[model samples]
Target: MFFSFWNSVVFIIICLILFIRFDTSDSGANNLHLFDANNAAEMFGNDVFFEILDPEVLRYTYRARPAKDFGVTFNETFYQREALLVPVEPPDSCGWPKNAHEIEGNIALVERGDCSFLSKTIRAQEVGAIAVIIADRRLVVDDDFYIEMIDDKTERTPQIPAAFLLGINGHMIRKTLKELDMRYAVVNIPLNITFVSFHEMNQPPWMIW
Candidate 1:
């Protein structure tokens, strides 16, 4: 009877050791988190990236035409303005500005060309933009802006809350608001983003070979 008891204790110790190793090694192995449009706000406190699942997160739309075409005469006004604009000659690796730390609280005007929509969002998050607006570099006429999150392996789960906007639409909104002498309205995004864990197997594995 004593020998059997000792054997059970040894088994428990081995199991404990295996559990610790597995848990540490597979940090994000089974860590799949999902969040929707409405509940995204709740995930602000958490460190994990809040994935926005709705197209409505993309609010504004704009045209890719030149500012002069819209009868805006001041060139300096466009450059010095706080509004985000997609560059005509976007960089090969399009990302938020290198000095993006300065624009943390401000909006990120991202150029849409080389990378995926998810990449733009990640870049915006890195720079500390509360929100991101992307403009298409393609210069397609009458193009209504639409951005979609492409599911790719490189798309690491977001560590910050993010959203997408069409480049042209975002530009038009900013321009119109400025022309009307109106302050850019703050949008309160109501999202239902959350993290949850559940049991899959009937019992935890005793050992991993």
Candidate 2:
């Protein structure tokens, strides 16, 4: 009789432990939502604004490449230059384990291919990234590419700033760093800006007017 009583007590204890763990996990997730940029800014006196670029907007593109390919022999410059390279995989499997962390404050260097541009930007934003730069894998292709974010089933639309660069551009940027005996350098290019108009209709004025 004593053995059975002890067994019951042990089972009850285990159940209580599991319940507490589950509750804690749920609470943690809830806390994360509260830290979202929009909410955090409001609570902390930080200013946040939305900048929506129509189909056309003036933007710049940058590049990344292997240093060895370029004869450049500088290491200090390269280290000073930091670009958040996004691995070509699911957010959970991306090459940079701290991709989100780095992107929050620095420029995000993302690999082209696999998943939509939107998915990459959204993932970056989750980690606090302010801007995004995508690198193409085709080093030889010299063409302009468009970036689109993946929405999946979620209603949230990614509204982060983003840009794209050719594979060669990336390589050249790396090369420039090496030539200057630097690990990296900032490559800025000017983009053309175009304004778009929104259409709205007004009701006809009443005869009394």
Question: lDDT of candidate 2 vs native?
Answer: 0.41
| Candidate 1 lDDT | 0.40
Which tens-of-lDDT digit does each residue in 168-194 have in candidate 1?
444444444456554333332322234
Stretches of model 2 off by over 4 angstroms after superposition: 1-96, 142-154, 174-209
Q: How close is each model in CA RMSD to the real structure?
A: 16.7, 20.8
lDDT, candidates in the order shown: 0.40, 0.41
* Top-scoring candidate (TM-score): 2
Please state the error at residue 3 of candidate 1 in Å. Answer: 99
